[model samples]
Target: MPKALKIAPPDDVLTMLEAGVAGDRVAFDGGSVQLIDAVERGHKVALHAIERNAPVRKFGFPIGRATRSIAAGEHVHVHNLQTALAGQHSYAFDTGANVVTPLPSTATFMGYRRADGRVGTRNEIWVLPTVGCVARTAERIARQAEARVAHLVDGVHAFAHPHGCSQLGHDLDGTRAILASLACHPNAAGAVIVGLGCEENQVAALLERIPQARRGSIRFLVAQASADEMAEGVALVEELARAAMAVRSPAGLDALVLGVKCGGSDGLSGLTANPLVGRMADHVTGAGGSAILTEIPEIFGAEHLLMARAASRATFDAIVTLVNGFKQHFIDHGEPVSENPSPGNIAGGITTLEEKSLGAVQKGGTSAVVDVIDYGVQVRARGLTVLEAPGNDAVSSTALAAAGATVILFTTGRGTPLGFPVPTVKIASNHDLAVRKPGWIDFDAGMVLDAGMDAADAALLQRIIAIASGEETAAERNGEREIAIWKRGVTL
Candidate 1:
């Protein structure tokens, strides 16, 4: 195997595939370099001398600037590199640069077709709590209901979150929106919305946000109005399950909506997992399918690249507002816009926010920004849609589910076992992590390093189809389903 990899021709740094001590020579595509300082695996090594304050290129873009003069083969990391990101800047819409050729849409997967014309990868029944006070009640109801109806449908699940009460204005609306969205998710054959009756987010009010056609498949229960909440909830779920027992049928690729995300990212993220997911994104959107990319904060430095692909001037303006609004959120809270790349990221070899952002955006592929939606809005476009969400794993994943992602393509370097409302296919950036956490990873993107992206892409697409057709992901098998609401306002 090559000792290091250079992602782009203009990159002045090479990412080490293995640890190297001083004086060790690392070979790459065009040339070789002897290490001037000891560098760990996945860390960056300068390929040539860099002057102080000069930008260091990676992924063919400036990741950051050199903090001081650096010698050839010197280790490049936080010690010598710093982010150059600041508050947002103006942007201009580029005309006709984002057009994508729609591929032949012959691919099909077996999925459940809903009454509303949406296709579902699963036929499970969901129990949702309107207030935090009734979360456990919902869980208890789902457990009992699943035991009885496991043979009738996929499975029963209750998504519990500590919100729906004590929230004001948009914060309260956010809770309602997410819950309403989940209740209407195509994956759920039917859903039961349990409310505490007196909470700010009442069951009746929440139902108003859901479409009139979708409300027929959903049941609601007010805990205070019930004689026995658990029994009432279970009965409701059983009724939904009976109605949800539908057989899967062939569905076209256009029915597939993917959520592309990355977490616990490492240096190899950009090279392997992310870019691999990017190919899948392109493939999906090329076939007229939809894909959603979130983690607004993670795209700070790379916002321009996405903006350049805006479908129209209106889309470009939305992209600008999305980027700047997130930055302002940080500033208003006295936090820097570049306050990211967590300690885990640093240890995994990522240096600055720019480097991380540049790598993170690859999951979106090169698709045109068809639309930019706010938090809690279900996706309406037929291509890559940028959703407003934070970079936190659960929150963004939940938002993705709420935005109508049937399956989430999650790429990671460091591993996480979390699954959201939908099946999350975890792709590992490096081989070591895939081997180390077999239970957490569904695909090894590290194969791209050796077998190349085409091979990896084919394999991953097959795995995704299988998963969509009812093959359980690692997260699903491990029973790691959960949700987290983005609590952006103060408590009452």
Candidate 2:
């Protein structure tokens, strides 16, 4: 039997956890009401009669205006509702604030300490290409060198992406930033940078951006400079491998950089996976580590909640710009800003961006917004920071990897089989998804509802430590790794 979940006191709709036939009595705090319609799991049912064109509330806020008069115990979804968001709007700092308690540093995770005082969860050797032209050559070098260097580093893998050449300004800069960030990422004990001569992103300029101490670990090659690029690239990787084979020092939890994200969301996301992950985020940030939250556009309706917890007025202002800028970007592209809660989301009982946003942000837990960063920028602060990115999973996840997230905590309701260059821990929002897709899911956050929250949080924190100590994620085993770069500017 599915019990109806009415999240807030003022909500006029109830999300059914399982289907109920007509006349079934559904109970809430006030009293029990007879069901007048069949409400599927994850779908909503009207708690009270709402007049035509009146607001339909969920998460204790208006999700949309009802298109037709809805009877109490009737289904409420796309057919009877429409979005209410439009254009840019004025925002105040805060009326009510989010609470974040400072947790004592008592927990720790064992990790590898780099020579530059950084920490890495993995010690793989990464091969990065300056342009798409040499992506194949970079991969060839990795494939051939993996066996030769298996006895040295953790593994040798190449990250290949499209669109490196014929790009101007930010487009080209975005490519360089992403590749360079990954090249210097903690997971990479050393890197083999492959460049096709004449590509806009040159080796010397890229090397200049890497940390001064770690620059020595990079091995460079220009495909056009050698007749046998494959052999030359392979030789360079071999040399890089031997250098990376050096022993790594033991490190603690403070060195961990986690990227938190949610995708394919449903009603259960907020109540289950996202909030659970947010608890983990708070744990990591409170323990003196770092956690980054991206998918900027997804934060739309719920921006005010985060703003209330902003560390300073400057950070709040940046959040405003980041939000309004994305709205304007949508306008310039001739797309509606309220175009969200995809078909799948609606089918799964998410009605509006507000509801979605509210649920989405639970992944941040109660952390204060300490910093904001541009796409491709690495995290420096030791708390929660926001990054500029669209809601596209691949692009944002790749950006998270570039931003120095040694491990990515990805929560999903519908679930995705995709993986980034780093270890991606897929957390399922519901037990059914976890049961059905055991191969794809690494954690079952749906259990948060049944098990005690404290026990769940402690278990998840331990799970994260196990992953940090070099346990292989399902994505790594299934070979779903890929990278997506943001292309915002015009191409020449």
Candidate 3:
């Protein structure tokens, strides 16, 4: 028999757990409903009669309003629902006590201790191009140098991007900031910054942004200045590799920094994968670690939930500015703030931006909002930080890595094979996706539906520790490593 779930007590809709044909009886908590129309799995069915313009509640909040009077057991979707979001609104900081008991720092992982006192999950050599003109050159240097230093470091890779030139003001500054951050990333014990000297982003200017302490292991090369740039790059990497060798030591759980993200989310994402990740976030933060939550536009209708949990009045005010600023960006572009729930999201049974945002924010669990930082800035706070970034998968994931995330917990219901600068643990929201794409999913959060959260949480936490201790994720095995910078300004 098909089954359905009513997520919260105030919810007026039931989400179908399995596909049901017309006239099929589906059971829920209170009563059974005979389907009036054929409904697909993950789709919502009205639990009771709803009048036109009435709020449809899910997750104990209004997802949208009924476009027309909806009969009991009828399908509740885009046809009958409409978003209630409009322009930005004012908000007041709630003075409730938001406290999280810090867990005893018992958990530990084997990691490399950097000279600057930060722990690194990997000790690889990275080649970064300062401009698009030298991207291929950087790649060639990495490929050639990896063979020579394969036994010394974990691996050698290059992150190539195209926005180092023809950008002005903040656009140019953002590009430089991100590059400088990547060069100083703990994962890369040593980095070779390759530059075309004539570009807008000069190697010297970019180097100025990097702290003097981190510059010891970083090498800079100008292709225009050297006759044999590739050979010189390889030699520099070889020297750094020899000097970058460090023994793995036991590091406390407090040393871990996580970037939580979601992509290709389905209806069950909130109930399973996202909430599972939220558990992990709470566990990490409670142990004095840090977790970052980005994708600003996706939080449009659900910002109030986070605002109420702000750690301080200043933190609450920063969140308001972060959210409203993103909304204004949308307005300036002549786009609607509620223009979300991509085609895949609709196919996966998500209805509006509110519904998606509600599910998306679950990755942060119930942690208080500790801080809010701009794009390309590294995380400074030790708890939950809300970052300023858009909702694109690559852009947000890359921003997460640059913000000092040693590992990223990425949840997906529709699956992807993309990885960023760090180890990306892809979690599936349903069992079917995990079984169908084993090569793409590292953990099956769908098991929460059957085995329950306690069993699943322990298993997932074990996997995170193992991955942090040098285990390769599915994305690593497939060689899906890549990075993308947010390009918000004009090309010229």
Ranking by lDDT: 1, 3, 2
Stretches of candidate 2 exceeding 4 Å from the true structure: 94-97, 246-250
lDDT of 1 at 245: 80
lDDT of 1 by residue, 185-271 (tens): 999989999999889998888999999999878999999999998889999999988887899999877899999999999999999
- Inter-residue clash pairs, candidate 2: none
Model 3 residue 40 CA deviation (Å) reads 1.5
* Candidate achieving the largest TM-score: 1
Report the C-alpha displacement of residue 477, candidate 1, in angstroms: 0.7
Instruction: Please identify which of the two predictions, 2 or 3, would achieve the higher lDDT against the true structure.
Output: 3
Write the residue-wise lDDT of candidate 3 on 1-492 in tens digits. Answer: 346764546888888877888898877776778889888887889888999999999888999999999998899999999899887889998873654554544678888888777888888999999999999999999999999999999989999898799988899999998889989899999999999889999999999989999999899999999999999999999999998877788987788889999999988898889989988888888888899999999998999988988999999999999999999999999999999999998888899999999999989978788999999999999889999889999999999989999999999989999999899999999888999999999999978878889899889988998999899999999988898988988888
lDDT of 2 at 183: 87
Which sections of candidate 3 miss by over 4 Å?
98-105
Which 10 consecutive positions of candidate 2 have the poorest summed lDDT? 1-10
- Give each model a TM-score: 0.98, 0.95, 0.98
